[model samples]
Target chain A: MIMTVTLTILCLLLILCFVTTSIIPTPVGACASLIGGFLLLSFIYGFLGAHFAAVIQIIVYAGAIMVVFVFVVMLLNVPTQDLPKVKISLADILSILLSIPVLILVSIKILNWQAPMIDSQNVEMKDIARKMFIDYLWPFELISFLLLTALVAAITVAHKNKGSRYMLKEGSDHGR
Target chain B: MTIIFSIIVFAMVLIVGFHVAPLMTWVERRQCAFIQRRVGPNRVGIFGFTLFGLGQPIADAVKLLFKEDGNPSYVQPFFYFIAPLIPSVTGLAALMVIPFGAQDTFFGTVFSPQVLSVGAGFLLFFAMSSMSVYGVTLAGWSSNNKYSLLGGLRASAQMISYELGMGLSLIPIVLIYQTLDLQQIVYAQSHSYLFGFLPDWGIFRAPVSFFIFLITIFAETNRLPFDLAEGEAELIAGFLVEYGGMRWSLFFLGEYAMMFAFSGLISCLFLGGYSLPYLTHESLIHIVQPILGSFGSIAVFLIEFATLIVKMSIIMLIFVQVRFTVPRFRYDQLMKLGWVTILPLALINLFVTALVLGYSSFK
Candidate 1:
């Protein structure tokens, strides 16, 4: 109940702020408001007692991310001329129409997730930890290594290609 | 009754949180001023101008309240907003697992204010805190600004690097206690190495864990020297560059709240929490509980809460002091410290702790 109230209040405030200050409003303002709404929703989720999921949501969605999109946008600098002109051919229209049933089916499956057992609660913290560390340790280590590799790749990408058009002749030919 | 009690506890905690957070700000300003040979907020509250600057924090709050909340043009709208909520929510959630004191049965009901008392509660808290990095990272990225992006990248690398060392470092304490319930861990520390009089803190029993834990605590909370995320001089408030008004305030609250939680965890697990010098459990009840009535059982409860606050304040003071005392670590050096130095040391600590615990159990 408290979490719900908090989320409602936060969302309303965020929306009010965005609408008021987004004087030279761009699509970005709307998108940001939507994201903020979800973030507050997750906080509500945390407050409602899904501690593990809430933290995971925060760390993955809010903490280390959202910036990737920003960086991509900045690098792309989507000018009016650069905007990809969509022809909206018949095939695209047909595909969009065909995807409606698939979306509905997915939503139905999601709504039927096993009924949350609010009363039958016996999941011990030690049991969860033992399983997580001992049984899942190998997979966990592998995932972390993968994340590290991703981090390295991201850093490399960010560093490379600065003034690359000129360096192409000097560096690319040598490397090739 | 349970619901009502939980509400009361929640309200008390919120009040305490709000009160302590601004006080910390005052402490930081006054200390910084002292170091620089300047008088701090002395002109505001009680003395100089008679307002005690007691109203400074309030004034700041009002300003934030009235400020025109602005969103940057380049930000990924969705992620930008989610950023602050992530850290703040995770921080508060982490506290659910922390035990306040020992539990006692009263009138056929087990009444313990220590929220969620599970066996692996300590690990759960650590995991929640580890996940808090996302808030800063996402905010930095979503801002669609260079300064913020750099801050986000740095925070990710720093947080992840330190996380490995921090997790490995805490294993030794787990080995010694052989339990994840924080209350049990504190109970284990009530006795001395030689006898009953001396304290049996984790620092004494497992010094390696103590050292690694301390280092990791600094990194985990993004305190001075480790505060690469908001290297204000360099990053311009880091990930929070684009945030304004109340949204910005949430992030600030989250950071301070995390600091308090980290200190509390450290105190509870390793520093004997509220365990007093030369005082037996029996004596505790006799001296303290009488005035409070059956609420005396709640004596340890209050002590645990106060001890946590005091310990956290001391740590925060140190954090502020260090911010003035030392220069910030270069980003690469920070990484090296976590991965190369702290990680290896943590592993060694774990092994040694395991060996000691094994021997003790067998004996």
Candidate 2:
């Protein structure tokens, strides 16, 4: 009940912000202010410091990033009816029911597990790096390579049609 | 007293958060105009201070308050609302570790100026910064907009790429000080830089480390030259494209607060937190006590706070100037600088610092 009340209040605050901005003036300030507040909250709680989270939030969420989304929406002109539909199958529902017990068991195990031996704050960068490079090195390297391959593949896909342009130029000489 | 201090700090943060964004807007215009040798905002106040058209920010606030805060019916309303909160909180909370002054005394009880003085403060700071990426990612996904989704993916990739180098760059400093506690690191700098006169600061002992650290800070903070995540001409505000109104303000507050926190960290780490040159803290404490009587501590507190603020302000000024001076990097170039240039140099510095420490320890 308390959680519900808190969530409702949060929703109301968002609504109040939404209504006030929509009713009176320019969208830029309203949007910037609203998003800016959320970004700060995440920075403090989501990460550890306001500095790291806040910078990432602003640049990715408010700065150049949001422009892309807005432009696409404007350009593509997605109408109200064109939205994609999702179908929740009966099998999926049954699988969810089956998974609840497993999830509860996992949570119980985690709850009973020993807390970290070392002071959480005292965990050094070297310890973190040692764990990353020694224990998780294979997975780390695999992910790096995967990312590289994905980048190359994206470029290849984007350029696939352009290859025909160069071949057409060569064919023009044969015709001549 | 802790409660009182906490309330005061919260109020100050709120005021600072509100004022900084508009102040930044003014600074941007004036700096841009100055570079082009044109007058800017001469009509808003006396002596043409125009409060630098300070009213413009107020005008902007009023304008945003009335605009239509629209969201598509298809968008997930819950996630859309929650997304911006993450970044804002993360940004504001980082101020906890920053010691704005040397110390604070409350009702004759001496207390450290910092809110949270944990021994492993720096690690805690990095962890917080890391968690803010979720806000960007969620905002993009929740919007159900293609452009937002793409922007979110790019941001996550960019943040992860730079984060590795950012974390690595600080290793030399930690090794040199033989400590991860920011306060301890600052205290360690109390030694002489040149046998007696120069105050030993991070920059003096490890110039290369300092240079790399400064650059990494710029990349980490996503300030111009390194601001690819928000490359407006290309991405149009990237991941936040769907956000508006007060939600938007939250993101703005987060950014400025983060900037403040970063400058404070740089001050604490490299510049020597509240430590003055050629003056022993003990001597000063001894000399000041007689003149002010019971209020001597308050006088000392004021001096330390002023000194810190001045140092931090100078650093912030440098950031603003750099913002105006530098050109943005291409996405590939930014990646290359982080992985190829920064990472290798950071590793070399770490090895060198470790070897030096080892040699000194044995000798």
Please tell me which predicted candidate would have the highest DockQ against the true structure: 1
lDDT of 1 at A78: 44
Off by over 4 Å in 1: A1-176, B46-53, B105-109, B278-283, B289-295, B298-300
Each prediction's DockQ against the real complex = 0.13, 0.06
Best by lDDT: 1
- The C-alpha lDDT values of all candidates are 0.69, 0.67
Against the correct fold, how does model 1 do in TM-score? Answer: 0.72
- The positional error of residue B168 in candidate 1, measured at the CA in angstroms, is 1.2
TM-scores for all predictions: 0.72, 0.68
**Residue B181 miss distance in model 1 (angstroms):** 1.2
TM-scores for chain A over all candidates: 0.50, 0.39
Poorly placed runs, candidate 2 (over 4 Å): A1-176, B46-52, B72-74
Give TM-score, chain B, model 2: 0.90
Candidate whose TM-score is highest: 1
Cα lDDT tens digits, model 1, B191-232, are 666666558888787777777877887887777889888899
User: Local error of candidate 1 at A69, Å?
Assistant: 11
